[model samples]
Target chain A: MSDDIRKKVFEIIAEQAVLEVSEIAPEHSPQDLGLDSLALVESIFAIEEAFGIEVPFNANAPQQGDFDISSIAAIAAAVERLVAEQRGA
Target chain B: MRRVVITGAGTINPLGHSVSETLAAMRAGRSAIGPLEIRDAGRLSVRIGAQVRDYVAEEHFSRQQLGLYDRFTQFALLAAAEALAQSGLPFPDGRTERAGVVLGTAGGGVGTWDESYRAVYEEGRNRVHPFVVPRLMNNAAAGHVSMRWNLKGPSFSVATACASSNHAMGLAAQMIRAGQAEVMLAGGSEAMLCFGGIKAWEGLRVMSRQACRPFSADRDGMVQGEGAAVFVFEEYEHARTRGAEILAEVAGFAMTSDAADIVMPSREGAARALAGALADAGLAPEQIGYINAHGTGTAANDRTECAAVADVFGAHAGRLMISSTKSMHGHLIGGTGAVELLACIMALREGVIAPTVGYRAPDPECPLDVVPNTAREARVEAVLSNAFAFGGFNAVLALRRA
Candidate 1:
């Protein structure tokens, strides 16, 4: 389930960046992958929709949002944790 | 003081898509108000609107441009292009830095907001477009125009409800008079004929479901319209030096606040604006030949406007021609004043008076010579365009033959 979530997250991020999923490495920064602030927010929205979980996002202070967006792996990990929490709740 | 003159004009309203087409339609006294073709029209109580029919975004803009340009921005760009082309005043070398853009719009990108909000709230969709913020900003149209024209001077947008375009044009002329800019692209645009735009106005109960018949006895209310009009306002000397064909002189402008009611029209405030405009133009009330009234087809607006005209112009009001083109083009809200300025230009330059169509029964209160149902040919030296917004904001502009 965790692998499936990570793969889906990478696909969504790649789509936003207008790149192939194979080109987006897990360790690469979303910004390095051409996801600007606007595209980053869109990726977060897509993640929230795919997982049916809320991802905190502040347009003014994006880095301080509850969701970690430092890199593709970090975002996937955060989404996985939120999904687990929602299931447990 | 520097004098400002209109060198070029363009418009894309319900009546037509260019200045020539719109003026021809006005000359024919044609009505553009008809059934609304917007999405979800069956759900709206107001089913009629003056929409700019046959406008396709894909035909004018590329995919990348369309992603950033909202409907209002597109309208402004189209109108601006025509105005600039007609002016033939090439911003040569350093002159580009001295030109600016000032546009008015009440709902800058409400259509974009409406679609995104509906997607997230009603359709249960989480992901929306990435450029939504840039697309929905109130200054988006101004910013795009500035970037396109390389206008590095003062560029901004004004939002004063229905009087926005008048305020914008007035301010742009002031900038030229104050030596801030040599040339300014001034006008306004609106695209609030969407589902959400009409739905919100439904609460106000001021919309007409049938047609807009301003200053008529059987008039119900104002109908909404969408489009844009743009003009090139240049220093009179600069235009003369370049051999540009001057359309009309923007002689004077005055704005007065009612400070009385939020929605109801005030006779005192309207009269003050009319008087102030005449004073600013250094002309007597009797010198004016025509007046494009701010007749919204509402009972309150028509009566109060007539009383104010009587108070200010007195006996001269009976002699001058007073008409409301809103009866034909409907009301463009923030963009209405800019479009109505076309009628004033026609009256001043071409000796043509656009009529107030859809006149059914005569209202004794509005007893002015409203050129009803047919266009009349008359030589008018000067005209005034009146725009009174909701919130008691009044702005009147004076124009004279060039």
Candidate 2:
């Protein structure tokens, strides 16, 4: 289920943004993936709306070092964590 | 200085072809937005646009004549014909040499470009259509209007992204004021509801998957629309002499540049333009009854425009009837303000205000009362039409009852 959700999430990001998931790895931040602050907010909205899960919003979730939203792997992991939280809740 | 007034109006929008048809559609709250019918829209996430359907060049122009014109040019010719018919102004005879034509367009001949590129890149065709350059030129519409009407004076086109038509009207007004022409055919035309056009807008990242819902909290982004709206502007005396039915006076206009950013809007820039237009019209904010907003259904634009309105009108901003007709017509880009200006003229003359179609929820950031979803009846005095373009080109025009 998380993988399927991740696939959808990656599709939206791939369609909207120029960077690819493989291009940005575990080391790169989402910002480095070129999801500007605004795009990040919008992406967050799209993800939550798409997956029916709320991302755990730590004050620094957006501020973590080298957060890579460009890579499908990173986005899937983030989405997986969020989905787990929603289910745990 | 001479005065300028709208002596005639014409349109071919998603609603219909005539001015009355479009106005009726707006009053009925019927949005012209629908599924794309032009090309293979399968790849696009957003598959809707306000397309002018069944508009065939062969039906309107002869093949030989059509060879010299693009879709934009054909639309301009038809719209100008309608405007001239409404104005009951025959070609000005020898005096036609003094009449001018100014048109606004953003995409020019984007359809032609798209087809040519496909032929060369995908089909590997070595030869392109010879009409490509003439058809694709941004000034083709103006040139066609000039040729169709025998207009000779000060003919040109102005392009300032979405603000194109408002700028054209402002310039036309100035030309009339300066006695450069006795009559001017002014407005804008766009036929960019093509594959290439939509692809170009995709790069902007602001297009909504659903319909445009300007000033709505749930609004995603703008829907593309295609059409032309033209106005016959004449010196007050010339129109009166010809017994033409005057619509609304081009009372005053103002323009400003943001100089801040290419894409983002500035409240300071918008406020200055709004204030300048009011000042130019020699009217106070309280006297203005309606405003056609440049609400592009984007988060940034609506909030910025709302804040700018609040900053300028204070409490009166709430009282003023404001709506973004783009909700119904979609964003015509360069032609939007011109077509929307027609709505303003209709409101002033008929004493009714059109509503912002597709407006559902109230946006917290955009606190303005955008006459939501339903057309309202009011004795409007003056209307202001605002257009803010991509590169921070801001233009405001104040139209009053003639």
Candidate 3:
């Protein structure tokens, strides 16, 4: 389940960045991958749609969100946790 | 004080997609207002609108650009591109740093908002598009234009309902006259012909279902339109130095407020704006030969505007050739004045007066010489473009032959 979530996360970010999934490194932040504010927001939206789970991200203050977005790995782990919690509920 | 002149003009209204096409349509006295073309047309009471037909998003913008640009921003950018190309004043070296963009739009991205809201409420969707906020904001059009042209100077958007474009053009001219910017891309755009946009206006009952017959006794109400018009307002000296083809001189502009009813038209406010514009231009009433009236085709606005024109021009009102191009293009709301200014420019530059196309019978309340249903060939030295908004906001601009 976590692997599936990770793969989906990288695909979504790659789509937003207009890059191949292989090009997106797990350690790289969205900015390091040339993802603008618009791209980041779209990635978040796509993640929510794919997982059917809401990610606590605010466009006005993106860094203050509960979901960690420091790197692609962090975003993937956050989505995994949210999906697990939703399944348990 | 510096002088400002229109170096270039571009528009995409119902009449035409280009300035040249629009001019030809005006000369032929063609009506662009026709059957509505929007989603859920069967549900709307006001089905007709003057929409930009056959507009394909992919043809005008890239996929990346389409993600950020709403229909209104697209219209503005397209119009601005044409205007800039016509001006031929390339922002070379550091000249781009001092140029700016000022636009007027009442609904900005109302289409985006309406679609997103419908998704959540009507379609029972939980998530909306991520770029919805940025796309729907009122300043989106202005911001996109500034970014596209690399205009780093003063940039903003105005929302004065129907008078928005007049206020924007007037303020842009003042920026040039005050020496704040060497050049300013000024105009307005609107894309409020969507289901939600028309539904909201239907409540006001100021919509004409059939035709927009301004100043005619059988006039019912206004027909909505969606499009844009943009112009290059440059300092006269700068344009002259560049040997740019000057379109027309933006002689003067004035704005006034009634401070009365929010929805009703004010003769006092309109008259004051007309008088103030002439005074600002330092031209007597007799010097002005034509007027492009607000003429919303609504009974109240047509009557009030005519009374105000008579009050200000008096005897000259009878001699001046006054007509409403809105009769052909339909009311573009916030963007209406910018498109109507084309009529004034045509009058001054081409010596062609665009006629009010759908005139049936004139009412005594509006007794001015409305050039009815036929374009007139006349060598007018100066012209006035009037715009009156719902909140008693009035803005009038004067232009002269280059």
* lDDT value, residue B271 of candidate 1: 96
Q: Which stretches of candidate 3 lie over 4 Å from their true place?
A: A1-89, B92-94
Better of 1 and 2 by lDDT: 1
Q: TM-score of predicted model 2?
A: 0.85
Clash pairs, candidate 3, are none
Candidate 1 ranges beyond 4 A from true positions: A1-89, B92-94
Total clashes in model 1, counting residue pairs 3 or more apart in sequence or in different chains: 0
Query: Model 2: residues >4 Å from true position, as ranges?
Result: A1-89, B92-94
**List of clashing residue pairs for candidate 1:** none
For candidate 1, write residues B1-402 as lDDT tens digits.
899999989889999989999999999999999998888999877789899988888999999999999999999999998899899977434488889989999889999999999999999999999999999998999999888878899999999999999999999999999999989999999999999999887546567777888888877788889899999999999999989999999999999999987777899999999999999888899889999999988877898999999999989999999999998888899899999999999999999999999998999989999899899999998999999998899999999899
Full-model lDDT for every candidate: 0.89, 0.84, 0.90
Report RMSD for candidate 1: 16.9
Please give the lDDT score for candidate 3: 0.90
lDDT of 3 by residue, B32-95 (tens): 8888978899998778888898888899899989898999999999999899989997753359
How accurate locally is residue B155 in candidate 2, as Cα lDDT from 0 to 100? 89
Q: Give the winner by TM-score.
A: 2
Question: What is the fraction of true interface contacts found in candidate 1?
Answer: 0.00
For A37-76, candidate 2 gives per-residue lDDT tens digits of 4566567667777878654321112323233454557767
